[model samples]
Structures are given as C-alpha cells and as structure tokens.
Target: MSAPFDLARQRFLTRCTVVSLPKPSPGAPPPSVVYYMHRDCRVQDNWAMVRASQLAREHSVPLKVFYPLFPSFGNMSSRQYSFQLAGLAAVEAELRELRVAFHLDHSSPPAAAVPAFAAAHGAIAVVTDHLPLRLLRSTNAAVAAELDALPGPVPLIQVDAANVVPVWEASGKREVGARTLRPKIGKLYGRFLTQFPPVPKMPAGSPLPPPTDWSAARAALKVAQVPDAPGLTAGTAAGMAHFRGFCETRLKKYAAVRNDPNEDAQSGMSPWVRFGQVGFQRLALDARKLGKHGEGVAAFIEEGVVRRELSDNFCFYNEEYDNLKGAAGWARESLELHNKDKREYTYTLAQFEKGETHDDLWNAAQLQLVGEGRMHGFMRMYWAKKILEWTESAEQALEWGLLLNDKYAMDGSCPNGYVGVAWSVMGTHDMGWKERDVFGKIRFMNYAGCKRKFQIEPFVSRYPPAAENCRKAGGEVALAPGVKAGKKKQKKA
Candidate 1:
C-alpha cells in the first residue's frame, strides 16, 4: 500500500483510509482528481473535499465533484429529496465559485457509477466521504474494486468527514455502549477536534459549466409524496445559522431540559448533520467556546461527538445493524425469550404509519413525526419502545421502527437513526432492565413514564389526532404547531 498523502497536519491523515492505491502510469497525466460527494455534501469544512483538492493541486489537475443521485434511496420521499437537492444546488454553486466542475450522475449502485465517472473524466484518483452503514460500506468496497480495475488503477480514498475521530480509528470493534466509546473518543479529541483549513481557491485549469437545473433534478426522483418539512430550511448557510441560533438560545437549557419533550432545548441540527450540510466538528468547535454554558457545552459534546460517533461505531462494525441480529447476545436472548409474550395491544404497520393507536401520547408522537418530519429525541425512545410493546416480535418491531424512522424523519436512513431505533426496541447499547411480560429484560417505556418526564397532555394537544381521520369526520383538522388554521373564506357572491 502507498504511504498516506503529504497533506498538512499529518494527524489528519488518520481520518482517511486508503482503500486502494493507483498504479504508476506510463501515459499522459490525468486531467482531474474526482471527489465523489456523498455523505458529506457541504463545500466547506469538509475533509474529503479538502483532501481531494489538495491531491488535485499535487498532481497539477483540476478537481471535479461527481455526485450520484439515486432515484430513491433510504425509503426517502419528496421531503428528504427536496432538502437534499436544495443542499446539492448550493454545493454546485459553491464549487462553481472555486472553479471545480460539479457533475450529477443519475445512477444506481454508486460503486459502478463513481468509477465510471472518474474514468470518463480522466481522473488520477478518487476521494469520497466515509459512512459506516452496511450499504455505504459495501458500495465503497465495490467502488474500490472498480477503481483498481481501471487502466491507471486510480486510487480510491475515503475520509471520515462525518465523525470527528474517524470511526475505524476510534475503535476496531463495535462498542458496547457510549460509555465504552466515550473514553476512546475523549482521548483522541485533542488531536482530531481542531479547526478545518479552508478549501482554498483551486488553480484555474478548466472553465466551469452552467449551474445545475435543480428543478429537473427533482423531477428525476421517483420518491414518495411526503411534503417538505414546514419550518426547517436546507443548505449549509441555513444549517450554520440554525446551529448559531441553538448556541445563542436553546443551548443554555440543553443540559437541563434536552430530554423534556415540552422544551425546545435540544440542538435541532440533526437534519443538517445527517445531510452533511455542515460538519459536526464545526458545531463542536463553536460550542466549546461558549464557556458561559459550561454544563450545556459538555452535554452537547457528549451527545454530538460521543453518542453520535458511538452510533457510527455500532453501525460500522455490525452488519445486521438494522435488525435484531445486531443486538447483543444478552439483548437478543432476552428478546427471544419474550418474543411470544402476549402483547396487550398489537398494531399493524399500517396503523403505526398512520398514527392510529390507542395511546394518545404515542399517537401524538407519531403524528409529530409524520407531520413535522421529526420527533423529539426523548419521544423517539418512547415511540420506538411502544412498537416493541405492541408488535408481534422484536424483529418486527425493529423492522417497523426502522421503516417509519427512515421514511418520515429527514435524518432517517443514517447510522444514528438505525442505532436509535435499535437502542429503543432491542436494547442495543443498553443493559437489560427488570424482566417484563413483552419487554423481557429490554427496557420498557409507558404513558405514565412519559407523563413523569413532560406534560404529555399539552404535547398531545400540540399534535391533535391524525389529519385524515379528522377530515373523514368532516371536521376542520388542527394544524401543526406554528401553522394556524386560517379562517375559512365566506362563500363568494
């Protein structure tokens, strides 16, 4: 294997994995180095982008960004696509300013599409962001294989742009819990949690093409019909603005009330982080400066860096990340023991998806996710556990929970979502609690439990019954929070 690239801050090279190295060529030099923008979409504070640009400059080649847009990925809808496309539009504009050509490939199995794009562009090397999920890992492997087969054997390099300390570097095996992973991350934070060097202006080698037609891009997706999230805006600028607002406002209360569903205390940057519109490292760096909110900053770092990275570790090392098989031996054994325990209430996937359940709080949480494209972090635990309580088996609960989360939440289809649902339903990354009928040793959540934490009734009131149900009764359905029901217009003369 070739030695790591001679980029500044040799420590940063630890964040990269050289999957394959290019063969020395005896022909004309390639024209560009291709950076396949996938998980990390932003043009700034992106290590993969930075590394790719540096590689391009080293070889005296232009940098080209190849983005493969799948027609449908991760059970996404128009809501997710709209947000993603909007972000990519901004990425294209930013790349234009840097004189880096942006190419969008409407392709599948990015492994094939990416290498082909690189070869077509005469790329000497391919660099892409790393993700720890099964699909992403497998795709990366396949891409590496294809790149190795090319005439020049173009190098395929991966940068862990999403996590502060790279996943593989943090731990070689799956961590038991945040407790196990936290110390490891804490040790490395000093070395990894530093400021990012700006992606400098590229050497002018090639003229850029006209900007991407985002409308046509959206038209190409065969996604679900979910509407855009009402209030949340997409793109790095909006995401950065939101993070600043969180630090200025909600962050002070984050440590105290982040778990209370009634308070807006959590940093609402999950969607941005999920979409890679902004780097979590940037957020962590800025948050650390707020020494005034010492407790809050500590809590944010724990959750954002420690817990988030833990999720990546879980998904990275475990192949069955989305299912019961991914659970620990203790969790799986306990779940199996309780698999046939009679559930007081069992709901089908349809009922779960439509938020038609007996529990008002559960239904409200479901409605919140369906309508708002997000559920509070605290409620998500409850929301998923109830699926276990009401589902036929732990396997079904895992399946349904993942499906619903990925379909509705903008941050769905990520390592965090997989681990969150797994933690809730199968007790992954958690110790077994007192044995219960359906829950076995898996931790149980209930309506009374939610009441103890927050004002369930008011939270329920914020999200009334499902809209379709109310409409079926010929009644005016209450809208989501911040969207007032406008007065009906009088009949025209």
Candidate 2:
C-alpha cells in the first residue's frame, strides 16, 4: 500500500483492518473509491475518510462518501436524527467544496445498503470508519460478507477514526479500568496522536451528490416524537466554535468546578463528539496546545483521551458490554449477592422517565436528561447508582439505565454511554467497594455526598420536579432546595 500514507499506518497496521482485497479489474474508466461515513462523520480530521481519499488518488479513481441512513437508529428519535442530519448536511456541503460526491442511501440495514451501493457504483475499494457498538460491528461484518460474495469483489477496509488512540491497538482485551488502559495508550499516543493530513480535493467532474434533501429526510424519519434540544446547533463548525469558546473561557475553571453541577464548567462537546461531528484527537490536540490551562488540560486529557478511549476499549473487547455479564468477576458476584436485598424505594420505568422519584435531586437530574438531552457528569453517577438502589435487580437496573440513557441523552447508544451506565450499575470498570445493602460491592453515590460537593439547590432549582412528582415524593420537594439531607427544618409543633 505504498508504505502506508503516514505515521498511523507505519506504527500500527491495526489502525486499518483489511477485510478483503480484490484483484484489479480490466477497465477503461477507473472504478471509484467508496468512503462509508459511519462512526466518524466529519469531513476533515477523520482518518477513515483521509485513507479513502489517499486510496482514490493512488488508484486514480473518483472519491465518494456514502452515509447509509436508516429511518430509525436504535431508540434515537427526532432529537438525535435532527442533530445527525444537520451535521450530515454540513458534511455534504464540505465534501462538495472538496469536490467529492456524497451519497445518502436510505437503506433499512447498512450491511445490505453499503455493499449494494458499492457494487452499483463500480467501487474498487470500500473504506469505512470503525464503531465498537454491536449494531455497527455486526453491520461491518455483514457488509464484508456481502462484498466477498459479489461477482467482482472489492477490498473492505476500516479505520479507527473515533478515538485518539485506536481501540484495538490500545488493548487486546477488556481493560479492568482506566488505570490498566491508560499506560497502554500513553506509550502509543505519540505515534497515533499526530496531526491529521488533509483529504485532498478530488479532481472535478463527478456530480456532487445532490444537496441532501434534509426536509424530506426529516419527514421520512420513523422516530420524530422526541423534541430536538433547544439551543444545540449541529455541525463541525459549531462544535469547533463551542470548543474554542470553552478553551477561552470555561477551561481555566474546569479543573476546579467540573464536578459542580451549578457551574457551567463542562466542555459540552459530547453531542458533537459522539455524533462524529468532531474528533477526539482534534479535541486532545487543541487542548494540549492550551498550556496556560495546564490543570484543566490535564484533566481534559484524562477525561477525553484516557477515560473516553478506555470506554471504547471496554466496548470493543467485551462482548457483554451493556449488561451484568460484562462486569468484573468480583463485581458480578457482589451484585448477585445483593440481588435479593430489599429496596427502600423502587420506581417503575414510567416513573423514572417522568422524574417522579422521591429524591428531588435525582428527579432533577432525570428532568435535565429528558429536557436538555444531557445531565451533569457528576449527577449521572448519582443518577445511575440510584437506579440500582431503587430497581428490582441488578439486571433490571442495568436494563432501565441503558434504556433511559439511550432514549434521552444525545450521546446515547455509543460505547461511552454503555460504559458509563455499566460503571454506575454493574461496576464494569470500577473496583468493588465496601459491601453495602442494596449496592453490595459496587461504588455507591448518595445525595449527601453530592450536597457536600456542590450547591445542590441551584442545580435542583433549575429543573424542579413537577408538582405531581413533588406530591408523589410526599412533599419533600421544598426541603431539597438549599437544605442538606437530615438537616431539613423541623415543622413548628
């Protein structure tokens, strides 16, 4: 492959997986190179797309980007579809400027869609981005199978464009935690973290895939009930601008106030990053350049690269990623030990969805997730742990947690969401803690701990429980605001 385009190919051939290599066909007009935009959706800073462009240039073939759009993706609704399509609209525009054709295939299953599209387009090679999630992985496998079955088979290649360090290269097995995976990525980051080369403009002539029919696309969506987030704009440009704003203003305080829900200290880039509108490597590279915010930069790297990639590593290596089966042996045993324990509070999925839980803080967090499409990072830990506390079994808890997260959060259905919920309920990457009644050995989080960490009232006040929820919680809603647990003012006798 001409000594592999750059350092990425040189250091770790694992960065790209060669599924099938078809022999060159005798033809006059060279075949096209297909870049299937899946996990990483951006125009630039995407290794998968870059590699496809390189292959097209080398083979003297036209370059094309195809996104197989399903009417519905998992539990995703209009909220997610709107954001995704908006970003894709930008992708079409950018690819047009670069003179590359962008095709939107509204096929039911991408596995079928991708190979059929390649065959129809006379593709010589198909390059795509990697996603560890089961659906995408299965789709990749099925596509590879279909490609191999074709009369004139073409090579199928995958690039790990999502993570700063490729998941497979980072670790071969499911890592126990960030501690185990951090060093492995640290050793390899120098080689993989280098700046991405531009995806050179393709020679003109191939018609730009008609400007995406976004309205028709939206109208065709099967899941359109969920409302889109209020102020969240979707596009690489907006995502980059958000990151720049964070670096300029919020980054300095990120280290200190990130845990405080009341502070707007988060990077707020998850929706963009998760949707592949922005790349993690880009975030890390940009953050590393801000030496002035050293502490924040370090913390950001810990979260963005080490922690985030750790989630990817977990999902990629562990087949049972979203359930109790994926938990550590000790964690599984501990959860099993506590499975029969009585719960002081148990709420149905409907109640949980409505934020009708007794704890106002938990209710507020749930409200934030439903209303804003995300919850505070600190609160998410408390939120999921409480599910384990209130649900019937560890299994049910994991189920409910995943359901809610996948249904609500903009970044839901990704490895990070799976790992986050697993960490909270099943202790996937966390160690067993001191045994407790409902939680057993898994890490425990409570309202009091949150109160100690941040001003609970300000955050809770922002998303107050509905009056009906307050009534259901036995009128404790008034006590939640600014009042510490166990110190609520006693009613006058």
Candidate 3:
C-alpha cells in the first residue's frame, strides 16, 4: 500500500509526458528507476523527483537521481556554473534527508552517459525534466534514442517542473502573445498549484551514496567564473530569502518602479529560478500565502507565469527562437525593407563588449552585465535595440546580443533570454511600433526616450562607461529629433 501523499504525487505524474517502452520478458529482474536530472535542481518542491520516487515505489525498486556535467552543456559561463553547482550541493543534502540516491558524473555528454549508465545499472525507467532550448531538446532526443536501442526496453518520462502550468498543457501550438496565453494559464494554474507533498521517506536503512565533493566539481568545470552577482547567493534557502525580501520591500512598488533601471525593485528571482533552485509555483504559492504585495502581486504573476511560460511555448514549438527567422512575417518584412538604410554609427562586437559605444547609457548597461553578471530588466530591451541600431543587419544584432546575454546574465542562455533578445531584435511576441531606419516597424527606443522613463544619469554614473577604451565612429554624419548619441542630436535617417 502506498502512502496517501505518494498517491497524490503519482496522480500528478499524469500531467507529465510519459512514454512506456516494451516491458522486460518473464523471469527478468526488477529494474531500478533513474531520474536524469537536468533543468530543475531542487529536491523539495520538485515534481519530477516526486514522480520518480512514486514509480520506484510502485515497482518496489530503487530510485536514483543522476546529473551530467558538460561545460558546453548550454554555453554557460563560469558564474552560471558556480551558481548551479552551489544550488545542487543543497539538493544533494536535501535528497539524502529524503533517502533518495543522488549521482553526478563529469561525463562528456548526457546523451551517452545517461543511457549507458541506465543500461549497465539495470534500470527500468528513466525520468527527466522538460527543456525547450534547441541544444537540450536535441540532446534529449539523442538520449531517448540511446536508451531505446538498449536490451529490452527503458521507459522515458519527461516532467515540466519548470512552469506552474506545464508548457505543453498551457498551449498546443506557439502562442501569439501574453494575452492569448494568459486566459488559459489563469484557468489552469490553480489546478496545478496545489500544495506540494513533502519528500517521501525512502526505504529504511538503504545504503546511501558517497557525499559529492562540490569543490572538486566546481574546479573541474570547463567554464571559467568571471565576477559573481554581488550579494546574491545560490540554493533554495537563498532563493527564499530573496523572495521574502521582495515581499517586504519591493512587491508593493513593483509595478511602479520595475521599469526604472535606477531602482532595484524587481523580484530578482531569475538567477535562482533559472537554475530551478526555486520553483515558479513555489514562489507563487509562498507569495500568496504571505498575503502581502497589495496590487503588485498580479503584476508579478503576469511576468513570472504568463510571460515566462510564453517564452517556453515559443521555444518548445519554434526552432528558430534565437534569431530573426522566428519573428512574425510582418517583422521580418519590416526589417528587410529597412536593411539597406544607412546607420549614423556602427560598433563592432568587440567595441560593444568593451562598453565603448557612442552612447553612455548603452555603455553603462553593458558595463553592469560585464561587471556584475546581471543587468536590470528594463535596460535589457534598450541594450538590444541599441545593438540593432549600431549593427549592420538584424542577424548580426541578434548574434551580438545573444553572445553578451548568454555570456553575462546569470540567467541567460534560457528560453526567457532567447525570447527576450528575439522580442527586442526580431519582435517575436511584440507588434511593430513606429517605423524608422534600421529598426523599421519594430519598436524604436533611444537615449532620450530612456531618460524620460528613468534616471538615466544616475544609472550611467553608477556604472561608468569605459570612455578611454571607446573609439567613437560615424560621428556628426546623421542627426534626428529626440535620440542622443553624445552632443549630436539623434535624428531621423
């Protein structure tokens, strides 16, 4: 007989995508279950882990957690890996408390490591978290094929622990925008947002795996750490602390000052949420339980659940998420129409990387990313638009923006970042704004426009631009109304 809590969890597995392979022949040994952990890194409040445990108990077999380390896993930087491994350390300990075995290997690729390990270890089923990114999606397919080619059969299950409303469940096809996706999520999240059952106690007296040497694991990473995000720590505890701090200080003012780059009023949960240290559902539930935040709570949900899931929906259904190819036909047409238009100034990727752009505000945004491994959310759109303005083509702009974003933002190389860059450069979910040179019908934002929204001078002063390193080019050739690139007035082309 299974515990009632485990029963509830087992029922929840119905929400996951499960594929059952051919069952083993008669007189075969009972196979253990393995969860090939990837995206989500938490133990408590983790759906996939709970489902894996339930399946293992159903078969009266052992359950294990397996993590594969590849530096090139997602083009992650040292800072990204540092935050991930730190949170993972907490997961290992928490799982030990639950008596679930945790296994991590510095294997070349998960496609080979995961299936090979399951086959050699006599596993019955392999469970994993859902990921929509191109590389991860392809890797998952490869792993599934590898496992299927083995002896009898190995069932593969994928759980979407990332979103409160699973990406697929939210929508069948790519969503048009938040408005299209919001209604469905609003109707569905409540069902999936039930209280998470506590981690089940594994079989008593089961021999535990050896402790993971987190230090050695960090040292072995192929990615190199740059500067860490100041004052931010990794793990579930840290994530909780940050959430509480938001509720106390910023939640009430979130809608008001969230767009102001000068104020630190955002939730700041992306780093932890990106690494799965804190579940989006968990955050939503806790924030509501606190009964605080006044009106801003709805604003947070709109961004965290609706917009976040919309990013996943875009990535999962659309293959060209990282570039202009994924843009709406209107956007693509608009950019093509303006492609030949002359830009007043252009900057090489290296120059942009050095924060040597002609605009001090743009330079400051870049400096924050390079210096602190994080950037203000509002400035992200402005940063990418400036790249589009200075670059020769939309393709180059997307490439350059992704390069910096994935390299610097603690939560980059993700669906959100990919969709964000696409939103800014390619206009993925956004509709065309006023037509202009370089940007065409896509939205146009300039220094003067940004200054009107926030305290641009304070932000610029906070992170001084590398002026000595700057080599301003294409000066005085172009001028328009409103936009400012130094003393020259930004004018219409």
Candidate 4:
C-alpha cells in the first residue's frame, strides 16, 4: 500500500471519496479497517469517516474508529483531557448508531495501538485525518511506515477535513498575511462550501463494540496537574447549537464588534472547530447564505477559514513554527537590533501565569483565558505581544506564551495558537510596524491601545486583583498576581 491518495480531487460533491490504494491479492477477505487519529472527530459531516465508510462498503470490510489516549504528552492538560473524552464519548455514541465499532487505546501511541487493533481486527486499509501538529503528524507517518514494514500491505489514507478550502488547495507557499490569502480563499470558497451529507447508514454488524465508558475514560487521564475549570462542555451537538446561534444572531454585526471583548461579539466557536466537533465547510456554507449579513459573514469566514487554515499551512510546512527562528526576516532583524533596550518591567513565566504584570488590561486578558479556557481574539494579540515586550528574550516570550496558552486555553495546542503567538511575539503573519522597546519593528500592543478601544473597568472588575496573603501562599490560591504581592491589600484594608 502507498501513501494515502489525495481525496480533494473529488471536491465536495460527496461527503466521501474512494482512495485507490494498492489492493491485496484476489480471494483474500476484505480488510478490517480503522482511521488512526485527527480533527474530524465527529461522525456527522466528517469526510474522514465518510471516506472510511465508503472504503468499507466498497471492499465489504468492517470499519471502526480508533482514537489513542496517551496521558504523557506535554500539552495534554486535565481540561483538554476532559474535553476530548467528552467529545469522544459523543463520537462513540454516533458511531454506534451507524453500527460501526469504536476502540479506545489508552496505553500506547497510535502507531502501536492503531496497527495492533487493525491487525487484530484483520484491517487491510487504515484511513486517518490529517493534522498539522508535529507529534500527531509524526505519529501518523510512523503508523504508515510501520504498516508498510509488515508482511502484507495495510494502506493508510489521510483525509483533509479540518479546513474549508483544503490546505493544499489554499496555496502552495506560505501566505504573507490575510490580505494575500483572502482573495485566494474567496476564489475557492464556492467549490468547497457545501452542506454535509447525512451520515449514511450501514447494515448492522453483529452487536457492535460496547460504547466507551466516559466515566472510566475521564478517570484514566493522568496527564498534567491543572484542575479542571467548570462549565466547559464538549460535543458536536453543543458545537452545532453554538454555530447556529452565532449564524442567526451574531453574524449580522460580527464585522462591527468582533474585536470588542465585552460584546462577546465573536463566535466562540474556535474550541469546537479546534476539536473538529463542527465542520469548517459547514460554517463556510452557512456564512455564504446569510444575505443580509453577507459582509459580516464574509469577515468571519475570512478568519474562520482563510486565516485559520493558513495557520495549519504554516505549521504543516514549517517545523520551527513555535519558535522565533521561524519569524520573518524583518522581524528577526528588528528584534535583534533592540535586544538591549531599556525595559520598564520584567516578569517571569510564573508572574505572567498569575497575571501579575502591572497592566490591568493584560491581567484581564490572562484572566479570561485562565478562568474560562478562552480569550477574545483581539485580546490574545495584546496579551502575547506584551509578553515579548516584558520578557527577557523573544524566544522566552514565545516559550512562555505557548506554554501558558496550551496549558490554560481550550483552543490552545493548535496551528492558530502557534501562528498567533508567533505573530504577536515575532510578527510571522504580519508586517513591520512602528519601532518600540523589546519588540522593535515588530507589531506593538499597549495597555493604552486596549484602553482606547474597549471599556476596561468591567473587565478589570471581573477578575479582581489577587490579595497579598493569597499571592504569598504560592499554591492554587496564589495563582493571581496582586494577591501574592500584597498589591490589593492596601485597597481592601
């Protein structure tokens, strides 16, 4: 079996497409197949599942969904773990309804878990969704390599369902900015923006695998130590409900107020999109149909599809995306030039995590993420660029930002998060701006800028400054800056 054939050639005509991988000799039973891992987690509107089912139907094989759970990864937090498990539970139920088996590999990497499961099930061809992250990408590649090394051929097909316009179809080279990529995405939108076909029903196989036990799965997550934040639900049903509400009400004024944190004008759909609970293509289709809100819909689509896909493109093609070394030449040169500039203040990663910086707006932005697992998009830029300004090094700023983001944010550990941090810290997806300390010619964001744009009092009031005694405690209670430092003590006393 060869590498997964590119299925984008079939366009969006059908939810599924056949990948003509090299077949085994005649008279052999059809392959028992599984999809390795990736973004299209949902059964409905998932091209990978569609393609996998199509293959199963074509070869008269049994199809199953395999998602491996390794609790040791760096970015796997309790919050993320809980979110994924809940979503997978939903996926398990959905797949069961379709009479397909779903397996949970809790002990090993996908390479070990998936192939072993496939071999056990007598799977001949395995199809997985494409992802841009280093670990997952390597995992899929390794799985394919291992399968090839086996005695008989076991084809692995990778489907691109995360992006509205396929990543490859968007552009061959990295886009310089949204402006450059906007028209390219606009041109191709019509071709890819279409409704998701209902998940085709397959004949019931004899008593499909047992549904994943959500309780057991949650208990098994032994990764990072962060306590779970409350009120963060996960599932495709929730994602679709949120999307429908946004399209019906918020899409009208999205262009006007998306940047206003207080308005909550932006569609809080990134976490859903990141988790692949809702299809990007589906969002694009609905946005186009919004006649009265066309401008707003277009604006939202630009960020949701074009800008979002560009992040995947960057991470996919460039291994160094998470570092300052991957920044544009202009940003690199400018940052080096200002390496010795005087700084008003310097904050350690710990201080930043606690939202301890002098700026209230920055703290508010940090609070939004830490407290709620999300931040307003505009505030995210302000939050990260300030890290570059206040940190010891550009590299340190990037490190701290990425660390904090992945640890706390629900939508973190994504291409958008990496590119966003880089863009804020090192100007990767942006151009030169007015020269400034720490940042030099790279984009600069200031408390005054945020103050000018939105009402800060409400935000500041929302996350009150930490108390001194609590701050000094240096535990969960010490997570806030003002509390640890006794800054809030004077006012309270």
Best by TM-score: 2
Candidate 3 lDDT by residue in tens digits, 228-271: 76777999999999898899888989978899997888998999
Q: What is the TM-score of each candidate against the true structure?
A: 0.89, 0.92, 0.90, 0.88
Candidate 4, lDDT over the whole model: 0.74
- Candidate that scores best on lDDT: 2
Model 2 misplacement above 4 A: 1-30, 466-468, 478-493
Alpha carbon lDDT at 309, candidate 2: 92
Q: Per-residue lDDT for 188 in model 2?
A: 89
Worst 10 residues of 3 by lDDT: 7-16
User: lDDT at 419 for candidate 2?
Assistant: 93
54: Cα error in model 2, Å:
0.5
- Residue 367 error, candidate 1, Å: 0.8
* C-alpha lDDT of all candidate models, in order: 0.82, 0.82, 0.79, 0.74
lDDT of 4 by residue, 1-493 (tens): 1123246722321122333433666665446667765677788777777777777777766777888876545565888777877888888888787888888877676668776776666666777777778787677767767766654656777778888777778887778878887888788876666666565667766457766766766677776767666666789899888888888888778999888887867888887888888777777776676667878887887788878988987887788899867888899899889877877668888788888766666776787788888888988998888888888888888998999999988888888999999989888878899887777999777656776798765666677763322234332222233345433322110
Under the 3 Å rule for N, CA and C atoms, how many clashes does model 4 have?
A: 8
- For model 1, the stretches where C-alpha displacement exceeds 4 angstroms are 1-30, 107-109, 466-493
Model 2: how large is the Cα RMSD against the reference? Answer: 3.7
**Residue 393, model 4, lDDT:** 84
lDDT assessment of candidate 1: 0.82
